[model samples]
Target: MNEKLMFRRWLDLASQNILTRYFEGEGEGSFAELPVRVRMISRFRWFMLAVFSFYGLAAYGAYQHSGVGFFLSSRQSLVLFGCMLLVVLYNTFYNFFPDKYIHNRRLMKVQAFFDLLFVTVLVHFTGGDVSWAWPLYLMVTFEAAILFDKRRSVIGFGFFASVLFGFLLLSEYIGVLHFIEVPFFEDHSHHTPLFSFLFWIWVCMLNGVLSIAATFLMNSLRHENREVRTSRESLSKFLESANDLIFSFTPEGDILYANSSWHNSLKYDLKESHQVKILQIIEDSARAKCMSNFKRVLEGDPFRVMEGRLVARDGSLIDIEGHLTLSTGPDNSVVLWAICRDITERKNAERQLFHLAHHDQLTGLPNRMFFVERLKQAQALAKRQEHKYAVIFIDLDRFKIINDTLGHAVGDSLLKETASRISAVVREIDTVGRLGGDEFIVLVSHLHDEEDARLVARKLLKAFTEPMKIDGNEIFMTLSL
Candidate 1:
């Protein structure tokens, strides 16, 4: 009994290990069932359904061929049917009420025991000496190997085979069954009791070979499946934990899937039904444009990029740049897998940098560097077109005196006000630049002549002559060109 218990425990462990390895290797979301109890119940239901259906068909066929009386006479058949029915009942109820048997180790062991009993009955019914039913023992051996450790599976096979052989010998000795006739070297004339005994020996040898082979094949398949599952799971983990907003959309512009970053960063949940349309999140005008672009991509065109504004859930707008590539499926259906980046901060920073690089930081006028580059380009264009351009350099008169008396901060404020005044006088085509402290330059392009430049400079000088308030002190300066 201790030995039997140990063997049973080993078998259980091995089967569980095989299942564990298979499930772990398959990949994430392989099993639809979440709770272990539910998964166990479902597995039990499936197993019982298959086993019972096979047994039911086999039993009905046997009764039809052999007659009900003959079937009833075979206690093996009765026992097998009864055990199969019990398995079906247990599994059905366990599926209905998973809490009862899902975690019951003792019940599982009993089920395994019944499985062994069923196999024994099958063996007896088929005539045990090298019959087709011997393969059924291999099936039982495989089940044991999957459920338990290698040692336990081996032990279980040996012990069960011994029991079967013992029953065969006893039944034959008591005349309950006849010993099968065996031939010698395929010659019926040479057949003898010795040949019969040898044939039985051969049956025993074949049973061992079949059991070992089945166990090996099942174990290898289980290991391979486990590896595949594990790899898939690792990949799923990476996708779920990734930082970038990973998402895919159908060619119809319906969102198919999105990772966690899409939900956390964009505050968009794809799992919801109302949010299925990708266009729903985009502004109406932009959505139409995007759809047109996506159509081009779906028509077997290569990768495309789109930049636009995305309105957030809170009604705030965010700038997004998406890099979209077409993923063609085996059936030639196109999918757009896009990685969208929030470029709001980057766009704002770029605009700020543009302002700083082109305009004077203090006075909001174009800086000398920007003025020089633009002037050179404009002058070349003007010369080609037989047009006129004017360049006027202005220096503030007695500006150093104001800086020395009223302080440089006051002088700087005055200069800034003076710049604003000059900017108002010039046309949009004219460019005003701050050369340095107390110095300014203006570029007038497409001008009639140098007279237009002089008139603009005179207006700027008169605008600055008005008494200017600098830090609550009045200061006056003349602009010299």
Candidate 2:
């Protein structure tokens, strides 16, 4: 299964609940609002269209009106119109064209060149030395910051500024554009051509200063945005790979988030439901206890833990140990983040160990220690019932003689057969225990008289007398009662 898709579904549900609470009691505000795909697409389209439209309108108005001597001539106006048309077409049809065509690196380079060419034409159309087109260099710097790496963007901006400066210096030297003359004295006659050169130098310095400042600010903002995106990506990756079942819940015990491990262990389809309460998914007995622990954590406790059973989808029980911690949000409300581990195997191992400790491994009957404990309880009950009881201790007669003649292996086989024969003669209410080698104990309770116990013991003795054949040898044995 795709784990990332599962996690995102959980987060979407959690965000819904959070938004509901945040807007609670405010009429018509209870509904959660998630940005839809269509809204995102529309916003992007509108933003790009607005930016290009605004620049196009401004250039067209400048060409038509010569206010402040910033108007372009016929050739410059035609170039500006062509550049604006290209921008409009690119933004409008980029989504329609295949991504390979729209995002071609060669095409981008061509667009950038045309953009610079239009700016240069506008500079020349106006008075080259004194035109306000110098401020339009901000657009070039902005494009560089958006479209290229920091070093490349800086280089692009520097190159555009150099070319524009060179054109301005050439125009001033060739007398194509009248240079501004600064009066060294209050008399016009004392003014020299050196004054005009100094004035142009000041204009150049101002243009350089403004362009660099705007570029630095734009680049800084872009860098900050990149860092934020990187941090978010790293956090998302860490959450997806985490082993523990991490979750958050409401104060009322509604589930907010459940990690992949939780769904896999419980075999539940968490994605199918939007809001699941803890009690709905957990076992009945554990529900109250789990909710209590959740409350304690939500009441500002840093850490609280509880162990209980979680019901799986197939109605089987799973042992779980849960840890909870309270986290305070920006709004001063409490949120419970919990981590749980499946302990089914550990619990099963513990039960198996307990069973092994009390029962005999060979015969699957009670061992000596357990028999003694049961005997004490039985003796107390027998006293209350006012019944006669007898403890029959049995030993296999000449058992070692048989072992020495045949082998201990044969002796062990005979002992096992003897125990089974004795057990068959005793009542179900009676207790049987193997004390040690060749010795066994039987506690017969609820007997009417001593004769009842004697009959059982005699039967056990007779049963052993029926010779047992081991390793092709016929052996006879007796039971001591």
- Displacement of the residue 35 alpha carbon in candidate 1, Å: 9.8
Residues 1-481 of candidate 2 have per-residue lDDT tens digits of: 6899999999998877754433222233211111121122223444645765687588667745754443345665576677667656754553354243334645444555555665665565544444556555555544444444455555556566656656665776677765443222224442345654664566556555645665676567556757766887897676656776677776766676777787777677776323657666678888888877776666665554688787767788888887888776656766777777888899999988876887676555677888899899888988999988899888878988888988988987777777787788888888888887788899988989989988987877777767888778888887777
lDDT of 1 by residue, 1-481 (tens): 9999999999999887766654333233433222342444346446646875787688677757762323334555576668667767765665576554445544544555666666655555544443455555555554444444354555566557656665664565457875343222233342345644675566567666766766676567657767877887897788778766667888666777777776776676655623557776676667877777677777766655687766666656667788777887645877788778878799999989998998888898889789989899988989899889888888889999989988889888888887888889888878889988989988888887778777887787778768987678877778888
lDDT of each: 0.68, 0.65
> Model 1: how far is 193 from its true place, Å?
7.9
Clashes of 2: 0
Give the Cα RMSD of candidate 1.
Answer: 11.5
Lowest summed lDDT across 10 adjacent residues in model 2 is found at: 29-38
Q: In every candidate, how many clashes are there? A: 17, 0
Candidate with maximal TM-score: 1
The deviation in Å at residue 366 for candidate 2 is 14
